[model samples]
Target: MMTRAFRTAAVVGAGTIGLSWTALFAAHGLTVRVSDPRPDLDEAVTEALTRYAPHLAARGLDVTGLADRVRIAADVTEAVRDADVVQENGPERAEFKRELFATLTREAPAHALLLSSSSAIPSTAFTAQLPDEAAARVLIGHPFNPPHLLPLVEVVPGARTGEDAVRAAVDFYTSLDRTPVVERVEIPGFVGNRLQNALSREAVSLVQQGVVTPEDLDRIVTDSLGLRWATVGPFLGAHLGGGPGGYRHLVEHIGASMQSLTDGPAPDADAQERLIGAVEKAYGSAPYAELSETRDRRQLAVLDALSETTGTTTPKEEN
Candidate 1:
């Protein structure tokens, strides 16, 4: 399925998230150039790729071949010189992103898809000032951490983003086996992060009020909502709840609850600290490793089952 490589792509920043993006793109048979000014960028990128090799294999990728296609660049200009796409994961600071995007826009191909992996920054804020207003080529391409495992990639267009650029970015990501969700408008935190922070804020409030321990609250999510969320999004889950018709009935009854819960105040500092302490006490020094391992394994099993059920066909060749 589209065995021809993606020609070339670049990953800027080469930090954990940037390296992870490089690994995923390389694993999908793209020739990747990674750039970061950090002194130890090479070592960090290599380490990330090494760790990701087997994970890609588990997801039906050919890691050994993919490794041969990657190149490390010493600077920004070299990285995007011939890149068809650039996934930038620079620091979250607005000025840094603005400067970085401006610089890359100068070197990147006129139509190159410039995607930011920033979790919080709206693409328009950073892209608005580029010469040629090539910021139109820039959009948010937020991938979940260790993107190789997660199929979801949010594609958010900035106010000035060209419609054609957005479409091409979606097509490119889809060709790499990612599920691309097009965000028609830019918003802070996008969708996933916003939902996560909302739940986390409430968890903090509960612990501050002594209504529940951190461990108990974590259990509720891990044991319930998390399971449902694994296969489908909340809206899809609600659509299914409507049974025979899908969404039509559910929206009529429960849409108001969703609206009502939208603007609740976030936790105060005292509540945040108490909850943070509860989490530290509950999980101690080592947190998320065991739980992550468990979740990854379970997710793999689920993928395996779904593959068998659907007849694990190779991706169809994209035109």
Candidate 2:
């Protein structure tokens, strides 16, 4: 029943996240005005759009004439003028964001939906200075890295945000074929990052303890947990792991062992060096740009296979 259309989107920031968002908006047929202080904004954005076009096409999105729809703006005010949705991907500094949001609240049209691409900073951190009415339209639309490919957009609303605005944000993302998961309660790092850090922490600990080399650790993940999690999440995997007995059976049998594992020591400074060295040796030799392109291509292929088998597209694909 939620029906909303975003015809023009303003992407504030010309960094990686912002550029990816610009490409995504253009692919979805929205007129995108990108603003950033960088002198090379036009060249950078154009290149990013070009890089992302094939990926978007592979995901079944229409990327025809995508570059023509994007325009580069000199400042935030110019970018957001007449924008239906303002996706801010500014610097993570709280003070800077507070000032930036205040400007957005003042200059942006009242009907405009102000969404931030902040990862850890909550909406309240910046919206605190805005008027109640303006604050109500602001919320977080945090996406994983490479927003053009990743479909998970965490829609976290501040305490003062309106329910209608949240619903509209969800509908807007859904229209773009994104899976927007609403965070009912605001928490640091939202949900995805928190879960990611939890696993990363353990991974680092294991390597620090000399239990596994970084390459071996990564291979284990890509082969086992990553493959399984790509299909079913941990909870569901646990449910299946219990056979016919279900989650209750899992807890009764392995809960104590799991608790013990959780008590493992955190990684220390030495572990950091070992992890860095191992990772550097494993993949640091290749140029990051090449590795990133390879990663995106492989991700697309995996998603294609997943879609064929599951009768549902991966988060990266249009639903």
Candidate 3:
């Protein structure tokens, strides 16, 4: 089994995701070094932790009096100097990441696992800059926003990445009480992002064609598909589709329909205009602040309840 917690982790950037990453590490008793050139980086980190700490406490997390472990550094080299792992949350552009990783190779600790929080770009595009660098130790560790609440972290390894590095990452995230799904192949958008985009495209297209308003479309998914997805993934759901026979019946029948699916074109100008109009009509001009607040509370409540019944610590103790 991997260690319980990463000893030290450097978070290189203090954007929204970067700050949340910092909070997660600090709350978990990991020494976290946060690096960012932004003048307000420290302020941003403070604000993010302040906003999220309460929610974490409510979930039975161990953030009590542990916030001070977060250290703000002026640059990447200083941040990663003694760290066991480094999580880069820098600009999404490939060129920017290339330069960052190259600099990291020269400064970061020899065995520190370097990971990117990128949703789309793969490590292959950036690790090239560190030719002699341990490319195998560099991989993607994309987390859902508000990393504390949502536990899914997609782990994608580059072609040259070693198995040890990949497994280490999975172990590291799991230690943080997060779910880590590893992708053997480095496909574009990985899995979650692609699945989200596929659904989003259809949702947008529906609204653009006046088939349904945005609110109604969102409702349809949330009331139906999202509820199911929250419990089980699409493939597993399909596995249960044919009852005892599993997906065998699905493949024998609907398999042909799947093959006939097309790579449709992007939404056009008219479609966008219609979509915008539909949004206004369905949701009205009222601000969604109240709605968002309500949704957040409800989601967190459900998560807390689920955690109680299907949590890590209690089940292990019982077993």
Candidate 4:
């Protein structure tokens, strides 16, 4: 059984992320109040729940009339009045977020968690207009494309964000069966999007340069790097690649060669210099043999799951 740290949730905005969040919240047994200025907010919510209901059921959540748990608030103020957490999925414009948060901080209960679905905008940027007290409770809760399926939720806090609020955010997401990775620093695009942007840049370059067609490029990544990354992260993957010697050996032998492989005219010297240190700082303490075994186990588990999905039956055709 899972513990629900929160009961009432106010989803501000009813767009893609907002709609998915609404469904996920309700599926997790949280009373959801959704606020959006859209005239078709009800239809949107219905369609989203209808689409996500099956997926939620596969994940062991009850989908029978799950829409009954949701309420469409007249406005943000009414929506957040009794909310235990307020998730803002308003426009990405910084000014819009700045203004939206002003109202959220004022209208939502003092104890209510304030989260934003901003992909690139940092919490500090929008929360700047807020006073210290309100800003302390505000943070970024950025999710991957579809919140209902993906488990990751980047919990990014501003300079003034309180430790309690950060901890609460993690607990809140965990309660919803979401994986909340609390970022140690606040940066635009946070970590996920930054890594995505970096990979995308090269991907576009490769396609444009006629190195590989888009279709084949995607197949290559999805079959190779994507599959590998699904188990251990890039950092851990590199650490494991070193076999018995670990990351230090990989750096000593092929670090320069790997850096040369990038398309950059000049590699970021500072990052290049810090590469070994940072990688070591994160993974050096782990016992090499045990870590390798763990990576292998994770890799096999992912492969086993893939075989079930891809071998016995073909994957669902993407629309």
Query: What TM-score do all the candidates reach, one by one?
Result: 0.76, 0.82, 0.79, 0.89
TM-score between model 3 and native: 0.79
Question: What tens-digit string does per-residue lDDT give for candidate 4 at 1-319?
Answer: 3433688999999999999999999999999999999999999999999999999999999878789999999999999999999999999999999999999999998989999999999999988878899999999999997999999999999999998889999999998899999997988999999999999999999999999999999999987898788878988889878866777788779878887886666556676558867888898888888887776677667766778867753343234
What local distance difference test score does each model get? 0.79, 0.86, 0.79, 0.90
> Which scores higher on TM-score, 1 or 3?
3
Residue 48, candidate 3: C-alpha displacement in angstroms: 1.2
Query: Model 4: runs farther than 4 Å from truth?
Result: 1-5, 263-281, 284-290, 307-319
Using lDDT, give the best candidate's number. Answer: 4
Candidate 1 lDDT for residue 304? 62
Report the C-alpha displacement of residue 249, candidate 1, in angstroms.
Answer: 5.5
Range of the 10 consecutive residues with the lowest summed lDDT in candidate 3: 310-319
lDDT comparing candidate 2 with the true structure: 0.86
Residue lDDT tens for model 2, 64-121? 8998999998789999988999999999988989999999888888899999999998
Instruction: Estimate, for each residue in 150-212, the C-alpha lDDT of model 3 and write its tens digit.
Output: 899999999878888888899889888899999988888889899999988998998999999
The backbone clash count of each candidate, in order, is 0, 0, 0, 0
Q: What order do you get sorting by TM-score, best first?
A: 4, 2, 3, 1
For candidate 3, give the lDDT of residue 96.
93
